[model samples]
Target: MLETPYVAVDVDVLDRNLAGMAAVARERGLGLRPHAKTHKCLEIARRQVEHGATGLTVATVSEAEVFAGGGFDDLFIAYPIWPSPGRAERLRALAGRVALRVGVDSAESAEALSAAVGPLDVLVEIDSGHHRSGVRPADAVRVAEAAERAGHRVRGIFTFPGHGYAPGQQHTAALDEAAALSAADLGDGVRSGGSTPTAPLAEGGALTEIRPGVYVFGDAQQVELGGCGWDDVALTVVATVVSRTGNRVIVDAGSKVLGADRLAWATGFGRLPEHPDARIVALSEHHATIEFPAEPPARGDVLRIAPNHVCATVNLADELVVVRGGAEADRWRVAARGANT
Candidate 1:
């Protein structure tokens, strides 16, 4: 009974999600290297390892440092990190401690990383459809060659397949990954690709590993995108209705806690589990405007809000109250919260 407006993790739901993703990986014969950026908690990371995850994927050096310090030996910094000046020594130090894998999408980045940390495992990031930091699939080979010339080991190619978040896009994203890998012409490299929405659609024949982050904690966006359902969301922001107006109710949980990640196709800022028709219309730093299609929530009423994105929401909290069997069991600190840099 710590009070409302706090983050809560449903243990049972979390376990189900973990098992489901693990089963998918096993069935497809793909290694599960779940992204640690979703939770950023050491305890959750350990649980992922227990669930048969081959290793962990992180986004930044700071996150890799946190996980490595917490005894996660195998880690992949999945972001394209430009190793320059002081960062070179830190990269070298990190590589020495754990089996570190870095991503390189360009020849310059590959050369810089290779020069910084000599003879380390590297993955060429192909832009399947996200059009983000990754290089074109046709250019992956050039980047790999550059990394090799710089003395780094090119192990494989990977893509995010982020376009799968849209409707009827998972199959196309997977095909893009295949096409890109084929164009890369890198033989024997681990073909890694996947996001939560696209993981189930992935054939796994070309992919040696699947890195799906949000599967650990389904969110409102997942439900809307058809990646998951309402019961599948494992984490929620438990808030208390503080005020009521005509057709509108205000909750204590706001953008600072719930995050502001409204996708174009999302219903609202977030979704209410108990009242599916109700919508989190607006989110300020301290107030959330909830619109009720049927009825307004009264003051002191407790509410659970499923966020649009779990990873960003988790980053905003300092700790999470883990609930099991409808009872609060434990509190876990958000160990790597704000480890963005």
Candidate 2:
């Protein structure tokens, strides 16, 4: 058996996830730019491309450079980046190598990126109720106009419906995304809409592209949001029980391995795929305390714990063991693990 506190990927389920999202995008007449931040593995990124992803979406210039170096040519930095001199130079080099695009939320960003990268393709970021990095939808046109005047090409608009992560808010977030993109209107450019939560609601009306990261590896948060089934989870931390109490078992995998990203609405720190009722009530540096409904498992017993955020968990691991049909297939490195520039 592999060592405890390591991330494992079931290739069968991973393939299922890849194809399912590809089919959804195709049926909806939308382009699939599956976000690479989730897995950050070159092997998974290759599979996504083979499964019909038009391009890859990354969060930072460094991540884009990593994927570009791996020969995944087409890429978009979905986050609204404030490019420092070093990052700008990197972006320039990456743009020279691949078909690169980035998200812009303000006139200053538009002007600065153009000056830095020399007339790159930029998509204005709309808020769409996320209230994060993006600007108001009604203000997207001004940004687009500023982009064009600044010597950059305004491709269209994109929004991250992050609020969809909450239970029963998927549809509303999707609708808000559509409405925001529609209101942003920069002629007939590619309108990008996000997130795994609202991906299923894409109906070909507003969005031309969908970027969903977590769908490739279902998580506890996805489970709680009704976005994916427990069986659909492709990645999990394989942990070994280290201590046993009356009704609780402490596992070797904890916040350090599984990531400490417990959503406010999340039931627990993590979830047990085998025992649905089990709750990972607490997590220490290298231990996860799970409260099981029944008798706690014996020490040394191995359990798979699905994390609340697959992206963060993936970022923490150095490599993910790939398994197929219940046997070890290969191991993939997290190539973009610290590409957080």
If scored against the real structure, what TM-score would every candidate get?
Answer: 0.97, 0.99
Q: In model 1, which range of ten residues has the least summed lDDT?
A: 176-185
Return model 1's CA RMSD, one decimal.
Answer: 1.2
lDDT of 2 by residue, 1-341 (tens): 67888899999999999999999999999999999999999999999999999999999998998899899999999988887899888988988899999999999998888787678989999999989989898898889999999999888899999989898999999999999989887889999997999999975889999999999999999999988898899999999998998999999998888999998999999899898999989889898889989898999998989999999999999999999887889999999998889
* Residue 204 CA displacement from its true place in model 1, Å: 1.6
lDDT of 1 by residue, 263-334 (tens): 888889999887889888889987999998877978999999999899999999999899998899999899
Candidate 2, residue 143: lDDT:
90
Candidate with best lDDT: 2
lDDT of each: 0.88, 0.92
- Pairs in clash, predicted candidate 2: none
Q: Positional deviation of 99 in candidate 1, in angstroms? A: 0.6
- TM-score, predicted candidate 1 vs. hidden true structure: 0.97
Residue 109, candidate 2: Cα error in Å is 1.0
For candidate 2, the lDDT comes to 0.92
